[model samples]
Target: MMAGRGTSRRQLLKLTGAAAVASAMPFSAGSAVAGERRHGLSVFGDLKYSADFTHFDYANPDAPKGGKFIFRAPSWGFNQNIQTFNSFNSFILKGDAPPRMELCFDTLMVRALDEPDAMYGLLAESVEIEDDGSTYIFNLRPEARFHDGSKVTAQDVAFSLILLKAEGHPQVRLPLKELLDTEVLDEYRVAVRFTGNHTRQLPLLVAGLPIFSKRYYTAYDFKQSTLTPPLSSGGYKVGKHAVGRYVEYHKVSDYWAKDLPVLVGQSNFEVIRIEFFRESQIAFEAFKKGNITYHEEFSSKTWATEYNFPAVEDGRVILKEFPDDRPSGAQGWFFNTRLEKFSDPRVRRAIGYAFDFEWANKSLFYGLYKRSQSFFQNSVLMAEGQPPADELALLEPFRGRVPDEVFGEAYLQPVSDESGFDRTLLRQASQLLREAGYTRDGSILVGPDGQPLEFEFLSNSKGFERITLPYIKNLERLGIKANFRLVDPAQYQSRLNDFDFDVTSRRFAINPTLANNDRDLWVSHAGEVKGGNNLAGIKDPVVDALVDKALNAITREDMNVAARALDRVLRSGHYWVPQWYKPVHSVALWDMFGYSNEPPHYDFPVESLWWFDQDKAQKIGKGG
Candidate 1:
């Protein structure tokens, strides 16, 4: 997770997991009747909202739509070191782009935040799948139009798929490779065919992709990184942007799908402005001064001690925490196993023992967080205690290949007393390092070639410095030269893309309903791909096999079993020094916004569904 509003790039990629599982079931013969179509689709269940249904159950269908709704960027709470963006092209692999660029484009289908794995039609009015589940046809609504008032044709849909597969980010291109071909049946209808052995989720993933305008790109270069905003069809268009300072979006008053069932009572703001700051402290100051209207705080120290400004004291600003029902995904110090020093599992496990999470949670975090024990924390997908019969069965074939402990008990992080120095854990870590070919000369641990056992802990966030400083002290106790290096956001991103770090912090978001996107995080091929999200540089064959089983799982029970197996193996490998997570979102804003009483089950789609309260805005003298 990145730190402030809207979906980050990591969140967008993780959301595809639901689509992957949704496509697991093959369509039946009766479902393929001629002219048959449905308004909504789900992976392994019936649609939550029927075709004749109005707006989603959680939506305020009659909510007034006016006033400005300002928020900040890099929505993840702790890692808020993002500075400036140079490109308007978010889908490509070139340059850093502004957050929330997806707001400008609409997908064929829009996900209902309230549902676990359901998508309703947006551009397409109805969709039909072949009996074999290999082919899907979407009937686009004739009312759909681009920002330029040009009709969104089936050709545009087909071209978007082809273009994204060829030139989009690796996360976009890898899954799209399963798409055999796409055909424009007519001006308003398109068919997508899947290759053999494709996961059921591929079709829904394809449908939920950001649909670009074929005509717009035809007149411009899609591969280059530029500041020129492309034409979009979503509820908002690019209003004003100052390269890296700020970007503003103006609501499309005559938006094509404003009244559609999936879009009803949403996109309430007339203007949505995103302001960027290089420092998290400065952004917080701006929020306190009313320059930024909405902010979701991530730092525990800030959340615990801050919010004492006059606005908060006088009840002008509202501070609230919303409960989240989804998995508390993994965030930790990821080891780059591509390096020879980190290749051994023993070395990774030894390094993991050096971090003192208990002290950090108590002293640094103000006791507001729980230790993240699983990749899928706070979710049922987590493997608990010992490996179950099913997980054991899955690991049976790779007995000698994997850690023997994986078969007996689930992996647990080393716990320590609140005191930063734990001699017991340090001794244990030293023993593990010794077994991995490191010998201590006096206080320094040396590798097989007489090189010092050292690695750089790379980060961009100044906020993380406090947390890493304490951990670095523990690493030093083990005779490990752990150096913390802070770089600019652009340089940090480039280093991550090129896998140029020995250790780095990353938060891996996981969906309750898993998807093939997990492969991009764990598979061997993904680790080899440049710009991929395999931050740990994992490339184990057994892990790859488990990922296949999880993605191809035909039933919920089977999916859980496979996911647990994968989690167990991953934990056993000790690829990350697990961090802590809070199950609720800590948010603070001016009391000028109104939202549904119920938060979405999976995500906090605050900007999309929350409306500007005209009365409240007027009271604050910031009326739109």
Candidate 2:
């Protein structure tokens, strides 16, 4: 469930001039406008929303559809045909791809109208849940096909599931594990049956799984599919590749589903290309030098002051910012429960008290981040204020799981410095440390072992490292010796898999379904021994029992009860020292592209209106 990518925070300052001209945003179109004329536009939206999004309307007005688009990602590799262990960028491509990927691929179901609820058919002609929600039947569009002439069959669907389940990323397998059976009724029909009662959000599981050719894959070694992508059935086919540098995809001129409602308003570009950059800073330089189409800003200083391009002033490089309620993907510190120092629930809650998020956001991120209180941010499910009648029905069961005070107003004792570090918070942290059997001397916490109760915090990104160091001072005051250690991607992965680190920072995306999360990250079974996503190495019988209740809830009421019960237990365990999340994605791109005035609730789709305007590209390059 954990993930990472790059973007800058200070986008408002860059967009101050452009917001002056836009007005009266329109509602998203219900379907794509076929036979639309081509007009070149280029766009950039953040990755979270892009995962399952394939419709062009979500991106922009479909236009200028005859040339190749070169997308630049910071990806390094890919997982075979499975969804697991692919490059970071490939991870997003599972359900959703970039502008090009969205244009190229389609899904059977998609998120409904920005609601974190259920899904609607995109490629599947119809889907019916039957037999008390234990069975699902999908009828695909009769004309769906890969770039080759072979017709898509129910066998392909079955093969995709078996292959993905066998080899895809662990997160990809979480939702489908309960899939007891999948039957190819006919060439155009498939039936999926779960182990028990199902969530309405079940179809969201099909977001990025394009049917693979069983014939082609059977002829080659499946494990090596990443290096040699099997003939795809999506919008674009592999055109060229320079290995680790870049990969190019050419649009299938006669793609069978091009005119389908699922693809409307998206896929304006005829070809898609992505150049991989080893360093993000180097990628930014490429964008400035016209080597890439856009740059997503995540740093406060860069957003406020970096876009000094003359094109920006002349409306050539337009920066766009919007307020939002969408989750920015929770990014913060996570503790390894496998480490004995943090085994006590009180210790984890005490650490949460030490984080000065308000100050961190204001001073470090220019107020671009919001403090997070729940795993699900900004959503109705988040446990906020006092537990309401509805919430209490769910939370009451796990009363002792979390602190009773957390259920009360005085739950998390406020740190002395609400905005920044305060000596008072330091003293409070020391007090908690003392209660936990640690003696503080000066700034070092001495444990029973006669050594400082400290461990190394590892991160791969410089940006995260910047935000992490501030808390070390607070830990020092509490007698805990905290060290900031930056590691490479390879070493980070090795350490995480080995459960070698005491703590680290990570963010996981939630797709409205709490069940998938339970299987992937929370269940005691997911801990290290299972080689699952139980990154925190926590194991508890109560949590395991709750996960079972959650998975088998047969009614809506039962589901909610299960959801809240599981949520309370997980939060109480304090597996992750949950941190703040940003609501809106701040994007800056050249003004050649046109998007709806309304901000996308889930993720901004850029395949619709964005096209490569050669004139604009040239003009901007000339500093015109």
Candidate 3:
């Protein structure tokens, strides 16, 4: 799903370290406890919330709850123009599911958004990790129950892990590979043992897996795509849904964890409705017509030119900008390295040089975007200037395996004079392509086999065409036949899953507390997986090793060093033509909602914390 803030499950398991001793330990076969049970778990630091803590610091416990909250569904996965969802199961790779389906299920552990990497008990009351971090034991809350009133047992947790690992989507299954086995000690306690080679974040990652009702799936196929909503344990459940038009989740009045410290001042809406549209313009029209209550604008052109409607002018609709502290991860036109045309790094770099970000930012984006330079852009993990001593030490082993530029200085994107057409960069790009066994014959660039160099730029968003048209012009100038093909969401998704595209735009949202997710996107094994996030089909051993180093890093400094090393290698690969990102979240909503002043650093938990204001709702009426 492009590994963004709302999509990537691994991002939720941001881990920091913690230590505690365990008592009343029970062993099952090869499992034995080596430490005390703790109320919460972190990677290498103390828990942000104490054992006696009531609620997260950002939550407003006394906030009023209850009216309906309606908003336009945010884009999910790589293709943003998802007009329809044929299935309710978001865990699998079969169909385009509705956005925020994770809202229905409860995980064993819930992360504290304010902290960098701290998660407290949710479905599970407490967690115990072995001293060596190989084994993690979770004590399920006896009172935890699914929507149908079925008890959430340790067996359910075990079954969920097994099911997800075996049949869930590549994003869901890939991260669980380190989990050796899950042992259900009793109705309430479950022990998850990991392979010795696993990373330190494995425990926290496993703990954050969404627990499904084992009995519910027994009546339905876990692998097949279906519209039937499964039973849920969270505060909301699938209420009423039209197969393509819209899906509404109604809050469970008798939710089991309503008063839980982790859940207090959250899930405030009585009903949360997500409506779909075939185009962003259609969605914007719906918002203007009051069919949609809230909108998070993505296109900078729209944000600047649009929004002059009567409602906005009358003060009924409020436009606000929120600060985002999370990493503005890499978003770009990713090349499919599996194809022979893109096999050479020089060819990829030459193609990247064709994208004029400076021109696009001014002409297309209304100068509202920043040129992305790193995989972990806008974060401390980003590699700056040259390689530091620690990062160089990490990169020294594979000197010849990586680009020579990696050792000298940080990789930078080709900059232009903001003229849309830069002759200097074009000349450099032409030189690079010529060096990579491509020669200009008449008007076409012919490869070593005398075949013309041509490729298709696939996209689902029509809005992207404005950006791609300019880039395509430059590619054409270099004798590269590049055409933009806008397809339906389903076809686009299928093509991406099968690696059938020559080039496409994708965003890999970097987690502040980086973990094993790097492997899922850049490692050798993931490139071979059909639906893995390695969109560029990266299979470099150096990248694989750097990902491992980052995952197992013991301290924040070590993690940054490993991450920066990995970033330098990836940037050097030129697997993608870098794009742009806005540091602030552009949000416009009707005045009928109330929310906490402080937003979470990692994610925007809009539906979870924002509640309906009855007085404002009455004044604004149902349709703004």
Model 1, which residues run further than 4 Å from truth? 1-35, 74-81
Clashes of each: 4, 34, 11
List model 3 lDDT by residue over 1-624, tens digit each.
121232453323221111111111122223224566677766665567788999988888987878777777653542122477888888788877887777788999888888767788898888776745667888889999998888999989999999988998887678878778999999999988887667766677777777988888887788987778888888888989887788999888999999999988988888899888778889889989888888888888888888888999998998998987888877888999999989999889998888888998888888888898988899999999989799998888888888899998898887899988899999999999989999999889999888999999998888888889989999999999999999987898899889999999877777787766556888888888877888899988788778877877667788888899989999999888888888888889988888866698877778887887888888888522
Give the per-residue lDDT of model 1 (tens digit) for 284-374.
Answer: 9999999999988888888889889899998889899889777877788899999988988898888888788888888888899888888
Q: What TM-score do all the candidates reach, one by one?
A: 0.95, 0.80, 0.94
TM-score of 2: 0.80
Per-residue accuracy of model 2 over 526-613 as CA lDDT, tens digit each: 6753324577876876566555555444444554555555555566666766666655556677654445667456544444345666
Q: What lDDT score is found at residue 589 in candidate 3?
A: 90
Q: After superposition, how far is residue 293 of candidate 2 from its true place, in Å?
A: 2.0
**Global Cα RMSD, each model:** 3.3, 10.2, 4.5
Q: Evaluate candidate 2 by giving its C-alpha RMSD to the native, one decimal.
A: 10.2
Q: lDDT of each model, Cα atoms only?
A: 0.80, 0.55, 0.80
